[model samples]
Target: MNVGEWAAVIGAAGSLLGGGGFFVARATVKAARATAAAQQAAALATAAPAQQAANLAVLEATVRRVDEENGALRGEQARFRSLLRAFAWTVDRWAGQMHRAGIEPEPVHPLVEEYNRTGV
Candidate 1:
């Protein structure tokens, strides 16, 4: 072929190849970006349940602590009640002795009356 013809043919081929390569490079970039976005979404999805489980563990620990505090409060209340009852019994005995020695007895306690009647 003539020099001019050969040059024209080679130039046309290079232009076509360059244009096709540009399109291929753009498609490759888009695919890589899409893959990266999908990976990020999957990572977030996997972490969500773990976060919820961690929150549940914290809540359960709080509930357990509260339950322990409530049990301690109940035991303290029982001990205080027992001490009060012992004091009441001592007073009742003293009042009875005073009556036997010539003083009138005090009226019975309503709580004691109720307890005697109901067995509580």
Candidate 2:
């Protein structure tokens, strides 16, 4: 072949090689980005369960504390109800005593009469 023809052939071969190399480089970059994204997703997937566990633990602790407070409030309410009942009984006894001695007693409060009726 002539030198000029040989040079043309070499130029064509170099262009084809350069173009193929550029495509290969671009594909490699795309694959690398995909791998990086997959790794980030995997890391987040692993951390999600741990974060959920932490949140659940906090919720359980809050529930336990609320239960304890509820128990204390229940006890206080029972004590207050007992005192109220005792007061109502004393008022009834005083009114009975005054009636027996022929003295006119003042009327009992409506709330006290309702409590006596309901026995609640």
Candidate 3:
């Protein structure tokens, strides 16, 4: 072949190689970006359910603790009420003894009558 024609053939081959390399590099970059995005999406999807379950567990624990506290408070209230009733009965008995001994009895309050009728 003539030198000019050989030079043209080599130049065309180099151009084709350069264009193919550029196309391959662009395809590789796009594929890598897509893979990274897909991985991020999968990780987020997996983490979301775990986070929700943890939140639910915490809420359940809080509810259980509140219920236990309420039960304890109720027990304390019952004990306090029993002590108050016992004191009221002792006061009434002492007053009765004082009346029998000829001392003037104190007037009964309405609240004391209600307390005598109901243990509360």
Candidate 2 stretches greater than 4 Å from native:
1-33
Span of ten consecutive residues with least summed lDDT in model 1: 2-11
Please give, for residues 8-98, the per-residue lDDT of candidate 3 as tens digits. 5655665688765555555556666777799999999999999999999999999999999999999999999889988898998999999
Q: After superposition, how far is residue 32 of candidate 1 from its true place, in Å?
A: 15
lDDT of 2 by residue, 24-63 (tens): 5555566667777999999999999999999999999999
Model 1 scores a C-alpha lDDT of 0.77
User: Model 3, which residues run further than 4 Å from truth?
Assistant: 1-45
> Against the hidden reference, what TM-scores do the models get?
0.53, 0.67, 0.55
**Candidates' C-alpha lDDT:** 0.77, 0.81, 0.80
Q: List residue ranges in candidate 1 displaced over 4 A.
A: 1-44, 116-119
Order of all candidates by TM-score, from best down to worst?
A: 2, 3, 1
